[model samples]
Target: MDNIVIKQPRLYTPLQIGLGSFVGGPIAMVYLLWQNFKTLGNQNGTQYTLAGGILFNVGLLLLLPQLPSNFPSIVIPFVYSLTALSIAATWQMRRDAIQHSVHYRFQPNWRVLLLSISLLIVWLGCAYGLGIWLDALGIIDLDGSAITAGKDELSF
Candidate 1:
């Protein structure tokens, strides 16, 4: 009898994260980070992947809401667009691993996923809350109304 090798789908990648970030928001990137933490350890470019994930988040939480909300909100999509560069960097780090057979059919670890997501929720909350606190304390206003004299306006 001959042994068989079955190829499986690639579940997550920087490109995947980059694209998913647009459609799925931070949750998708979090999933990729969780996958990275589980499968790879301090691999070359791991920092970039992690940084990409974090930056994706911060860009959304800290920078996106400035867009006027009266119409289709481009904040999330726009932020994700810029952050994709960070995620792309990680693709190099993951190249070998992604091509390996081991990663193809491996079972995703649930504990790591839960941990990543929980930490993300707390981290995002704190970071976002800090922004709100700064606005409240008059340190810097992120509401986009400051420039328009307290009225949110759509502008190019």
Candidate 2:
């Protein structure tokens, strides 16, 4: 009997993971990581990654409103993006080296792009829905009265 090794059909490159993180945030990065784990046939990694990712994102959402008004907006994105890239570089790269060849085919870039866009839409929708719910509950008003008016109101 000979040892048998099966190559992955498709795997995402680190670049794709980084871009997905940049556009879709930590959740998207986690999704990509989960996909990689699933593809590699590591059921435990897939499950843990998903659970951890959800918890992290939930914590993040809860903590976001507590940030000081003076806090820089870019910091959060920068931190998550860097973290995702680091994981891709270290973990995924090691897996690729062992399980895949130099000529291995990666998942298409468009798939990442689509996922990013879809995640963006979902995030925006959730935010909007929350805002509406809060408004209905008298917690916050979604009206534009709080916004400062521009000098000129021209037709689009």
Candidate 3:
């Protein structure tokens, strides 16, 4: 009797998704989820993930400033990571298991690392742009005028 070899699809584990969420925030979560949906040939899921991710990101931006100043910095990342993990497990894990069982190979860690770093850079660029916009609108000053003034007074 000959043994047949079966090939399994590569997918990201829920834990990996969660870590990506933690490191790259919501963008990474959205991307990982979208990729899974696309791979599974779930067009509806792909569309919904994109739309939901946009709404969630907008809502998060709007609500973040409303949080109390004393809010712990760690809580936001924790919440998003847990949410990503839950979503990945609920929507994709079942298919992942049903299709490949224990034979599935996980997506490479290098891809996740590259994604996290790339998204982090994108996030920082957005922040910088927002700062420039706010400064232009006179909402906040980004220049060093106040520091210069203080130094001038002290020098006298």
Candidate 4:
């Protein structure tokens, strides 16, 4: 028997891939937090991921209503902020993973990829729906009035 090593497709650089994973991990954490919020009361071991997810989703949700409506005005800055956070978090995690001798394997598993993509779409869709529900119920205001006046007025 021969030892054969099969190479996998590389969609991005190690850094890029790590960053993608890092970005995704928090998003996953956010979904977990939302699940917790839906099911259980505020308890232990949910704070860190919950807070991070809430902050990240808040930043993202702030941009959604303005997306395609305002364009280059508001969405760009929000995107920039998201990118900066993703990159910074990715860098930190990558450094830690390297130090801990984490294995960086790039296997092109269609099942895993499809499942992940589907899960992401569902998660984002649910978040958007939740935002809309909250907005309608006045539980939270997407118009940013709670933050500042004229904040939600889409400006170019």
Candidate 5:
């Protein structure tokens, strides 16, 4: 019998997965928000937004390890803190809105839906663009490598 070799596809690295998730998390959040806004009405918007924002921040934190070391630590903390504050404030506002019932009617807001869709598209596009830019700058290689013949071989 003759010896034979087999090759298997490589899985994405942690950093790559994190970056991809970071890019996707916000977009999906926005879409869900938009859908909630369209279908659920204003009373539900604040609750949905608050919950979605928290989840988005958590996803961002997961991506922190993949961030470039050159990134400023202060920026991440500031953004995270701001997001947390916003969530808290929104929760409070929703509570007040529910209590007062000051003719607060729930209505469909199309503008917000449009904005959400646009923002999601822009965000994902920018993420992909950044990946390309990083590759161009040789900061990171988007295409991974495979082990072959007892050596690492770069894949295109």
Candidate 6:
């Protein structure tokens, strides 16, 4: 046992700050994960993010279709956590690969890539709340009914 060493597993990463804040949704998450896989594959592939991506896709497949506009309050946090988990796990794998001298850089399109990713992040973050807020503001009719029909009413 003297030659054996145990490593404590880390569950989160600083990457979650940007990822969760901006790309913390099903579609953007999957795209980011795909980028991760493609980038890492060019260097040294890691199956961890692939599995996470699969899980995210599967979740999207099953839960996305059935989700109502008014999802549970808990769902946002849950999905954010899942998104954070994926980014954190993949970042860890990427760090490991880079430490081992795996070099993979897709040059010549960095500007386009940056602009697109920035647009995507902003679009996603804004879109997530826009519809709900619009509905809340009565600018959009969700089946022609008031969402807050009884929200402020006191029941006896």
- lDDT ranking of the models: 3, 2, 1, 6, 4, 5
lDDT minimum window of 10 residues, candidate 2? 146-155
Residue 152's lDDT in candidate 2: 38
lDDT of 4 by residue, 2-113 (tens): 9897753222223333333334443543442333333334354256556765686676666456466445654443454355345434432333443443333322445334
lDDT of 3 by residue, 1-156 (tens): 498877876778888889988898777888888887887778998999999988887677546545666999889889988988888899887445744666567788889888977886776666567667766886655695865787999994
Model 3 regions more than 4 Å off = 1-8, 65-68, 94-104, 140-156
Q: How accurate is candidate 6 locally (lDDT)?
A: 0.48
Query: How does each model score on TM-score?
Result: 0.46, 0.72, 0.74, 0.38, 0.37, 0.37
Mind giving the per-residue lDDT tens digits that candidate 6 earns over 89-149?
6453544443354343222234334634674565456554555665678766555444465
Name the best candidate (by TM-score).
3
Evaluation by lDDT, superior candidate among 4 and 5: 4
Ranking the candidates on TM-score from highest down gives 3, 2, 1, 4, 6, 5
Q: Report residue 36 deviation for candidate 1 (angstroms).
A: 2.7
By the lDDT metric, which is better: model 3 or model 5? 3
Better of 2 and 4 by TM-score: 2
- Tell how far residue 78 is off in model 1, in angstroms: 9.0
lDDT for model 3: 0.79
Off by over 4 Å in 1: 1-24, 27-31, 37-42, 74-104, 108-120, 139-156
Number of the top lDDT candidate = 3
- Candidate 5: Cα lDDT at 156: 47
Q: Which regions of candidate 2 fall more than 4 Å away from where they truly are?
A: 1-8, 94-104, 134-156
lDDT of 1 at 134: 73
Instruction: Please give the lDDT score at residue 72 for candidate 3.
Output: 96
TM-score of structure candidate 1: 0.46
The clash numbers for all candidates, in the given order, read 0, 0, 0, 0, 0, 0
Put down candidate 1 lDDT per residue, 1-156, tens digits, no spaces.
Answer: 598867654445455545554554575555564565545453544565567667766665765445565757766565654465365454423444565756453334453355445655665676678788878888777765686874445554
Alpha-carbon deviation at 113 in model 3, angstroms:
1.6
